[model samples]
Target: MVRKYSKNDEGVSAVIGVILMVAITVILAAVIAAFVFSMSNGVSKPYTVGITIKKTTSGAVSIVNSGGPDVGQLEHVYVTYQPVNGAAINAYNGEVPADGPDTDTLFDYIEKFDALKTVGGSFTIPAEGVGSPNKVPPTTPTHVIVTGYFKDGKQQVIGEADV
Candidate 1:
């Protein structure tokens, strides 16, 4: 009498199914981890500060801080005057003169704002000596940029305008 052996493939199929499930779970976890890490990098919100740019009757440009919740955290401020046909002048840390030819009292104004961090902090770029040696000219539009530096080592452009 010849006896035929029955094939026992049930155990092999169960093992393969378990391996497949584990592989899928690992792949899903990796995808979710990557997404979470990528999103976490941009979790910090930018500070909000109100800034206003106004044109004066004397052909000057004024940049003012209108106050905000984050104003108290502001450590320093920088002002840049870029004329249409002249080199850019940067005012920061009392570098610009209070009153002199080819310069304005921007540094003094900014210094006060940095110290006080109050609303209505303003600086003016004059157009009186336009085309002479002044950085801002009335006839030609000038671009003004105001940057605020925070105590947390964050820097942002608080205001910008062409006047």
Candidate 2:
């Protein structure tokens, strides 16, 4: 006797194919949802401002705002001077030592920068004894750092140079 095979198994295969397709669609939707939700967190970006620092022949350090999109957002700028042989001196709001006439002059420049946050703004910290006391010596290289405070309560080191 010869046996005959029929197409009764077709229904079973169709059912499995449908289940597999549904599973794949669910997994794809989940992946996409996770990606979409993860990017909605609010995070502020840092300000981008151009700054230039240089040491002049007179042994003074000059800081200039080269102008950038974020320059208008600057609220104040602070300068920190680190000499090769002494403790770091910060010139902000009259923080420099008052023992010398030069320090008083340096403080004045810092104050002016803080007041005027304009493009192409520049200030010079005079060499030691000239107007800045020994904090910035002429013979020794000093590290000058300029930090900008933004109106959004963010502070960043805008520029640094060895002068």
Candidate 3:
């Protein structure tokens, strides 16, 4: 009688397969968790607000909140005035509200709170803000650029109007 040698390798492959499946599942779960957490902590939707720029006969520029979504706690507003025939004037900063409103005032307050406006809010650009020491003659052919900054460091070009 001859003695034969047998190799018992049946369980080796099954063990490796199970381990690989478990590792893949763990990795997938980790990826999904990271995505969910990031989404939950990300920035929310941006506030919508409309602005209008106009020039008064007195040569002062006006920024009006025509209508739009309420932007809570504005940080600042910047205005750029470009006269049709003259150089552009920059570096005018807008004022923020002293406090946040309890209810929606987006369209209620007009110009009383500097650049921060409720709907229908209107702000007049002072002569000094426009880089003029004295009364500057109002120019019809001018472009008024208005920008609004929120507390979140996000800014929007509220409006650009030619007057």
Model 1 ranges with Cα > 4 A deviation: 1-44, 91-116, 129-139
The residue-by-residue lDDT of candidate 3 on 1-163, one tens digit each, is: 9999998978668889999999999999999999988887666676677886766667677788776755455665555566667555542423222342212533243223454446676767664444335333336676766667677777677778887
Residue 58, model 2: Cα distance from true site in angstroms: 1.2
lDDT of 2 by residue, 1-163 (tens): 9998776756558789999999999999999999998887766687888888888888777788888889889987877776778555664332444342244455355565673267888877766523323334534587777878788878788888887
> At residue 38, what lDDT does model 1 achieve?
92
lDDT of 2: 0.70
Task: Report every candidate's CA lDDT.
Answer: 0.67, 0.70, 0.61
After superposition, which runs of candidate 3 have C-alpha atoms over 4 Å from their true positions?
Answer: 1-46, 57-59, 91-113, 126-129, 132-138
lDDT of residue 137 for candidate 2 = 54
Q: Best candidate per lDDT, number?
A: 2
TM-score of 1: 0.62
- Give the better candidate number (1 or 2) by TM-score: 2
Residue 152: error of model 2 in Å? 1.3
Residue 74 in candidate 1, Cα distance off native in Å: 1.1
RMSD (Å) per prediction: 6.4, 6.5, 8.6
Alpha-carbon deviation at 88 in model 3, angstroms: 2.6
List the candidate numbers ranked by lDDT, top first.
2, 1, 3
